[model samples]
Each structure stands twice: as C-alpha cells, then as structure tokens.
Target: KKKVMADTNVFLDRLLNYDKENMKESTVEKMQPYIKDKNFRPEQVKQVSSALVGLCQWVIAIEKFYRVNKVVKPKKETLGIADAEFNAAMADLNVKKAELKAVDDRLALLQQTLDESNTKKQNLEDEFSNTEKKLTRATKLMAGLGGEKSRYTMQSESLGEVYSRILGDVVLSAGMIAYLGPFTSNYRQELTEGWQSLCKKDNIPGSERYVMANFMGDPVK
Candidate 1:
C-alpha cells in the first residue's frame, strides 16, 4: 500500500509539471481574442501586452491551484460523486475488518475450549483404564485365594478323618489293656497272637504289624 501511494505521488508530480508548462502558452493564446486593438503606441502596446501576460499567468495559476486542491464545482459533479463513493467503500472495508477480527476471536475461544475438553477426556480415559487394570488384578487375587481355601478345606477333611480313626483305635486299645491285668503276661501274649491272627485274616502287611503292636502297648498305656 505504501509503494502504491509513493508511485501515485510521483505520477502526480510529473503531471503537475507538464500542466504548468502548457498553462502559460495556452492562457496567452486564449487572451489574444480579446486584444483586437492594433492602433496602440509601441510603449503602451508593450505595457498592455505585459499586463495581459501577467493576467494570463494569474489565471493559469488559479486553475492549477483549483485542480491541485480538487475544488468541486457544480459543472464537475462527478468529482463529488467519486469522493462520496470512495468514502463509502472505505467505511465498508472498516466494517468488514471488524467482523473478521470478531470471527477470529470466536474461533480462538472455541479452539481453547475444545483443547480443554480433550484433555479432560484423556484424563477420564486414563482413570478408567487404571480402574479396569486394578479390578482385573483384584479378580485374579480373589480367584487365587479361593483356590487355596478350597485346597485347605479338602486337606482338613482328610486330616480329620485320619484323626478320628486314630482316636477310635486308641480308645479300643485302652479298653482292652484295662480289661487285661498288668500281672497277666501270659494273657497279653495270647492277646497279641490273636491280633496277629486277625491281621493275617484281614490281609495286613508285615511292615504295618508293628503299628498294631505299638497301638496296643504304648498308646494304650
């Protein structure tokens, strides 16, 4: 825009110089029509010619000044119309610039809001993912603990059955020992022989035979 203004000023300067050069010659030619008297003395003619020349110069100067200042007359209404239209165009451009600035501001605000929303959404997604992972870990832990509990219950039931059998055997052996007198070694031997015969009938192993002997003697006592 500045370059255009500089170029326009240069052109106007050249045009004004051209017009000034032509104005003096054209003005003198136009004034010659009014000067029809050829009877004047040499001195008077020179003086009147000089005066007419001055008047012509003044007229050209006034015209140049009027052109330079862009004085609008009734005969040249186009100048006024052109000036009005240029002013209207400039006003419209200002309004358009203001509207464009407002739109830019609105866009900036919306973009900021969108960015904040995205950040919140990302945080929520991260939190949900973390919660999901924690829940999965807890589920696995519970499942593992349940397996351990089930195994313990089964083991306890098996142990309880074995203890019940051992307790019954001990009680039966205690009754037998109490019935058989301590002084009757012969009768105790006979009882051992009878238990051995019963073991053989039941198909008991020789390695387990001492278990019955220990139960009858040590456990009973």
Candidate 2:
C-alpha cells in the first residue's frame, strides 16, 4: 500500500501527461479512494495490494524468527558434557544466530520502509477523499446557486461527491459494517443507481467489489 501510493501517483502522472508506453495495470493499483475519479483505475491498486500483502507477511515472519533466535545462547562451556557436544552446540548456535541476525536486520529495514509507505498511502487517501468532497460540495452548491437543476436527483453522486454531501458518510459506513454487520437485509435501488451514475465505466466495478453486493440485475451492480 505504501508502494501503491508512489506507483499510482507516478502512473497517474504518466497517464495525465500521455506517457503511455510504461503505464501498466499489472504493475500498479489506483487506491480505492480514487475509484470514482476519472484520473485512476482501481484494478491496479488491487493488484499491488494483493502482491505486497504476501510480501509483507513473509518479511514479518522473518523478523519474528530472528527475534526468537537472538535470545538463544551457546551452551555452558564448563559442562561435563562431551567435548564434541559442546563444540556442535557452539558452532550450530553461532551460525544460526548470525543468519537470524542478518534476517532480522533486513526485516527492520523493510518495516521502516513499510511504515513510511503506509504514511504516504494514508496521505494520498486523505487527499483523494477530501478532493472528492470539495468537488461534490462545489457541484451541489453550484446547482443550488443557480436554477432548479437540483431536480436531477441522484440517489448518490460519485463517491468523491457523495461523501462530501453526506457528512461522515464514510465513517458511518465503517461503523455500520463493523458494528451492525453487513448491510444486506435492506438495500435501495436509488442508492445503486446513484453510485452507478457517479462511476465511470472504468472505476465502478472496483468500488463495488469492496462490498459483497448481491446485485439484483446485471452483475455490473
């Protein structure tokens, strides 16, 4: 996810600037926060997150093993045990400790990198969210400022916009999911339509995927 932000930003820059040759979906993910924005596609973000999670788990395990190994010490030298036995334990523990120490160091570096990456990702998500809200509010506020175009009601707007209009909608949604469980029993078509209307063809599917929607019609929902 940390890499996701840098890579996605680079990709977006390239896309907006028309650097088409190297912009590859297989290599990146357009973070979920920007799924509704025409500037990015979420499939790229899903790919990167899935790949990085496996790598992160692998590195975390290596770190744990190293920490466990560091606590081990050579057997007592004064033991009446066989000379060969002492030699074997000393040799084995030394090599294992060294190898584990190296792994531990590597893990520490990776962890630092991951932390920095997460911070950047979080920043990007916040920016993406806030930008969406501002745009939505501006749109709605603009409509109300003029004539009765407000009659063109949407159950919702682009995620960026909808979130802006509904204060704490995202936070509330998180609460609903975490505390109340899945919002399966009661669903609204207008909600579905509003989301659909807001989403461009490229990004809609990605946002819909985060929630397991039992769609009524075309699977596109």
Candidate 3:
C-alpha cells in the first residue's frame, strides 16, 4: 500500500515537471526529447517498479491464502487448476510402479517359502510311509502270522527298534521352515526351547507355540 502511494506521488510529480522545465528555445533545442520526458525520471521509474513489485507480492499472498485457508477450494477436477492436478497424478502413477514392484517381490518370496515348505512336507510323508512299511514287515516276522500286528501289543525287542525309529525320525510339515524330530523324544523340547528364545526376542507370546510346534514337528500321537 505504501509502495502504491509512492508510485502515485512520483507519477503526479512527472505531470508537474513538464510545465516547470519548459525552457528557452535554445535550451529546448539542446535537450533530447527522451531527457525531457515525464516518464524517464529515475525516481519515477523506482516508484512504478515498487508499485508493480507490491502488486505482485499482494497477488502471491492472495494465491497462497486461497491455497491454505481455502475460502473457496476447488474440486479434484477444478476448472482452472486441471493442469497442476494432472501433473501431480502422473507423478503418483510413476511412483506407484515401484511400490507395486516391491509388493511383487514380497509375494514372490512368500511363494518360494511356501513351495520349499511343501517339498519338505512331502519328504516327511515319504519317511513316514517308509517307517510304516518297515513296521509292517517287523510285525509279520515277529508274529509268524503273515499278517499285520498291533504295534502296541507286540512289544518285542527287535520291533521296539522300529518303534524307536518311528519316534526319532526327522520330519517336516506345513507352514514352517525348521525340521523337527520324533514324537516320543526330546527333539520337540529342543525345538521349543530354541523357538522360545526366538519368540522372546521378538516379543511374541507362547500360546502361538502349540500351532507353531505342530506345524514344525511331526504329530505326537
């Protein structure tokens, strides 16, 4: 506002100078028309420059106030600001590709983990099948009956070896990376202790162990 006053005052002085400086013909002939002009004064130029600068500053402040305080906020697709919003949308789209690629990497890693877990589970199943085959043969040889026998009732020393193998065989199962040992041995206890240490570090509770254990170890019964 002060700058506007200064500029107005200078412009008024310019109009006044034309009347005062009208000189003799010899002096007027010696003077350049450019030098005689009301608009050419240095003070007049500064005043106009200041007023323009002030006007620009005021316009910028109004624009910023409209942006922040929002006396009237435009929509996503506003009339005059579409170019600005379009550029922002394109920038977001450019960023989204990298974000989606990171998600894809995580999904790929999870899929590989799942596949490895399944393969290990299949190997455990094969081990179980082999153990069952051996137990069947031992039962037939011990009973001398050419038929399957109850594992619990037979209790012979040689067949007990097969029972111990069944109890101690390393096995794998679904949804876990670590392998575990048999049902009747301390392998499960070892695994539990190790996992407890890990879970404690991670601040997870022990109740999840039942599910995690069954997933990591062979069945108990």
Candidate 4:
C-alpha cells in the first residue's frame, strides 16, 4: 500500500511537471521508463497499464477534437461564401426589379400617347368626312341651278337694251298720240304700223309687235 501510494504521488507529480504543449509526447516519455523496466513489481505494472490506458483515451479525445475542428472550419468558410453570394444575388434582383418598373412606366406613357394620337386621328377623319359632304352638296346645288342662271343672264341683257331705248320709245308714243287723235281707226293703225317699222329700222327699243289699238283703246268698248 505504501508503494502504491508512492507510485500514485510520483505519477501526479510527473503529470504536473510535464510540458502542457506536447502533453502526449511528455506523458509517453515519462511512462516509457516504467514499461521497459521488466523488473517492476505487479503493482507497478498495474499502475503503468492504467496510466497507458488513460493516455490512450486522452490522445483519442484530442484527435477527435482536432478532426471535428478541421471539418467544421471548411464548412464555416463555405457557409460564409454562400452567404455573400446570396446577398449579391438579392441586390441584383432588386436592380432588375427597378428596371422592370421603369419599363412599365415608359410603356404606360407610350400607351397614353398612342391613345391620344388615335383620338386626334379619329377627330380629323370625322372633320374631313363632314367637309366632303358639304362640298358634295354645294356641287349638286350648282349643277341643279345651271339652266336658271343662264335664263337670268339673258333677262339681264334684255333689260339693259330696253333701258338704252326707253327715252326714244316714250317720245315717239307721245307724238303719235297727239297727231293721230282726229284720224279714223284704220288710218291710225296704218300710220302707227309705218312708224313702228321705221323705228325698228332705226334700232329703237319698243314692243316687238306693236299695235296702236291695243295701247290707247278703252276697256269699256
């Protein structure tokens, strides 16, 4: 029991004094002496065996920790890269959305312009149709009045000729009335016809077929 106690105290002392940075190597170096010493007693062998088992367990635990960290570090780096990529993608999507909104606004403006133009075009077409209809009606009216216009022109020319001869005709009729009052009806008619023939030869204006009886005869007779 005393030897076991001594061995345990020596083991604890060695554990405390060993290099912490290279724990596995220092612990193995310290235990190597006991393993190779074949002259050790049963208790010493048992203690050494127990220490080796514990050392193996520590080494395994440390190795597992290192392996887990190695794998987790790369995974963390990959996750960071993926996060950055996701943020970039989201930013690009936002830009594209803004562009699409601008396009939609432009399209709406263009549509408004097109609608206004169409409305203007329709109004112009309607105005043209009305103008064409008015022109057609005017043309037809002019065509229908063609003969009446010609007749009015002839009447106007005849009145102008009569105006030129009005004074001469009035004097001749007055002279005949004063000179022929004492004559018989037959003599009056003959004299009036002769005067009318002479007036026509002189280009005087009067009735085309003049008769003295028709002008001065009484309605009661």
Q: List model 1 lDDT by residue over 32-83, tens digit each.
A: 5544335333445457686445444544455555555454444357767888
Stretches of candidate 2 above 4 Å error?
1-81, 148-221
TM-score of every model versus the real structure: 0.44, 0.29, 0.29, 0.47
By lDDT, the best candidate is: 4
- Per-model lDDT: 0.64, 0.53, 0.56, 0.71
- The 10-residue segment with the lowest total lDDT in model 3: 167-176
- Steric clash pairs (candidate 2): 28-44, 29-44, 29-45, 30-45
Provide the lDDT at 7 for model 4. 83
RMSD of every candidate to native, in Å, equals 14.7, 56.2, 33.8, 13.1
Q: Ranking by lDDT, best first?
A: 4, 1, 3, 2
Residue 178 of model 2, lDDT score: 60
Error of 4 at 49 (Å): 38
lDDT of 4: 0.71
Cα lDDT tens digits, model 3, 84-172, are: 87788889997998899999999999999999999999999999999999999988788775334454456576556544433222221
**Candidate 3, clashing residue pairs?**
none
- lDDT agreement of model 3 with the native: 0.56
Top-TM-score structure, candidate number: 4
